[model samples]
Target: MTTSDVMQDVLGVILGGGQGTRLYPLTQKRSKPAVPLAGKYRLIDIPISNCLNAGIEKIAILTQFNSVSLHRHIYRTYRRDMFTEGWVEILAAQQTLQGNLWYQGTADAVRQQLTEIQRSNAKYVLILAGDHLYQMDYREFVRYHIETEADITLAVQPVEAKLAAGLGIVKRNSDGQIVEFCEKPDLDALDELESMPDSDKPFMASMGIYVFSMEMLAELLASPGNDFGKDIITGVLSERRVMGYVFDGYWADIGTIRRFYEANLEMVSPTRPFDLNNARRPIYTHPRFLPPCEVYGAKLDQVLLTDGCRIYDAEITNAVIGLRSIIGSKVVIKDSVIMGADYYESEEDRTKNRQLGRPDVGIGEGSVIAGALIDKNARIGKRVQIRNLSDRPDETHQNWAARDGLIVVPKSAAIPDETVI
Candidate 1:
């Protein structure tokens, strides 16, 4: 078949994440996929954009936990033109005659919606995680799967030993045929799981990106399995024509608060690991046609400042200031991800803020925010210091929390004037 025909035959399924407890309050009001990332875009945008860029137009996002926002985002951002046959749809888990429970795990999630997925009449199904950061061309991955006539192909990458203990380690033959798999193998088991003997990053880790032939996907879902890594992939390793497609690109699983915090900061670093602004491969999101960012004497060094921001004589370093952000004068924000407001606060909104004894929906003057993540619509008052001064690894307060010593101001959280954290 031609390349266009092959792409037409492929359907992409993105597994919208469950209750992100590790990501906690950031996910308190939204699903993992709906969680904000890199200032303007949400996590789900990554895989969807990758699919659209790779020519896979018919995509479905499986949602379960706090999925209203996710559904709304997909609806608003990914609407296809009237002339196009492409669509990005959401598949929510619900009660069925066969089962009433919500998805138990990754495989179970797909199994619950297998009938719906099959309705696409796709020859191949490409499965992707909703909450990952990377740029990939899936055409090459599908091409590899087709050329080798593989039943299933997993994108694998060599990761540092420190990261292997928490990831699915795979042992593949020289021909890239996957032979063994262990989910989150212990450090002691690394020797046997090493796909590369003496490489600097010895263990080959699964990137959680997979492409399965349509028949194989149906056959595998017949069994009772929860997660893909812990149950399904493990059970089929020795029996199936599974192969590993080695990927040497930047990929991150921002499943935890620390990883999420670090990943956002990395975007504003000098050595940016992943570039979200590639002209040829743009990351798509909802177009909020707000005015250009208004900056008056703001000293920004290594920052990702999005649209509709008003910064006045502030010193910002190594931060991702999101859209519609308002920073007052003398504000010092460093190593932070400031997810700005959902809507511009009118005079009435400021009146409500005054009644509640909170600042307006932005960072007030003379505040210092370091190593923190301030969620959208937060009201941080003047002289509020949020640097996690206690040095606690994990702690939860009323309006904020600390994970890995990074202060997190939850969505719509309010920090009063002169309050120090």
Candidate 2:
């Protein structure tokens, strides 16, 4: 196939149906893809933005598990002239010949939406994940696939050996053709590979982004597979021609709570692994109508607070605050992730100790917090004290504390003010 052949009618499909169980309370009400990102975007927006930036207009978002918010956001933000040609659309599971149940797995999710995909009449299909933060031009990957004429092309990155355990490892020949692939290999299993890069750093990690010929995806799906990475991809790794596209760009799998918070905090730095300003490929998210964030008598440094957020005499450092959140007087929020929105102790009640919202979690009018994540729509009391750590190493707490001392507060929890530890 020539470059033009692959690019002639490219179809973009995003797998956004996962339960996001790892994110727990954050995913309590919303799907993983709908989770707030950088206080201004949703996780799903990253891949959609990549598609638009790549000049690929034909797209389908496959979603399940509390997808209303995800659907609404996509519809509201992207329903425009751009989608008229090979437009962007949402493909939810409906009653079909196979079954009426929800998606069984990643592969099944796509397979279930075969009818919608087939309508595109596209020669190539790009499968993507909605729970990641990165920017890549799919056109480049498509061009590479056409040049190599490989059955499949996978995007991979080099990560530490320990971290690679959770991801699939690709073993490629000198020509970049993948010979063998391992999904979540044990620590001792890597010693057998001769081509594995021998360095202080570890081996490569799978980015979960794939470019597949429409025929190949259809054939693979028909051959009996439950999941994408675990079943279909691995089953064909050794039998068919598969190539690995080693990606050196910024990428993070927001699969867990700690990872989700860490990724948000990383953005507070002046220089981040992922640069959103790159004109070559820009990231996308839902648009917010709120005005610019206002900070008055607040000390903010190395923080990313979205628009419509109000900060009053608060000291915030190294944090990511979502839209429409408010920080009250003389409060200090440090190294945390705060999703926006307001709530109330009582719909008719509002007081220093009774106010509801992000800043409503009162800090005793003067309290300190470090390394914590406060979810959206929470009511916190004034003069209340909460920290990520305890001075006594032997003490046991109900909260889950990360190895780096980050504390997580469940979403929508009512924290009374003047409550001290």
**Candidate 2 global TM-score:** 0.89
Locate the minimum summed-lDDT window of 10 residues in model 2. 392-401
Model 2, 201-266: lDDT tens per residue?
446667888989889989999988878777888899778888878777889899987788889888
lDDT of each: 0.91, 0.76
* Worst lDDT 10-window in candidate 1: 386-395
TM-score of 1: 0.98
Tens-digit lDDT string for candidate 1 (174-214): 99999999988887888898888878997789988899988
Instruction: Assess every candidate by TM-score.
Output: 0.98, 0.89
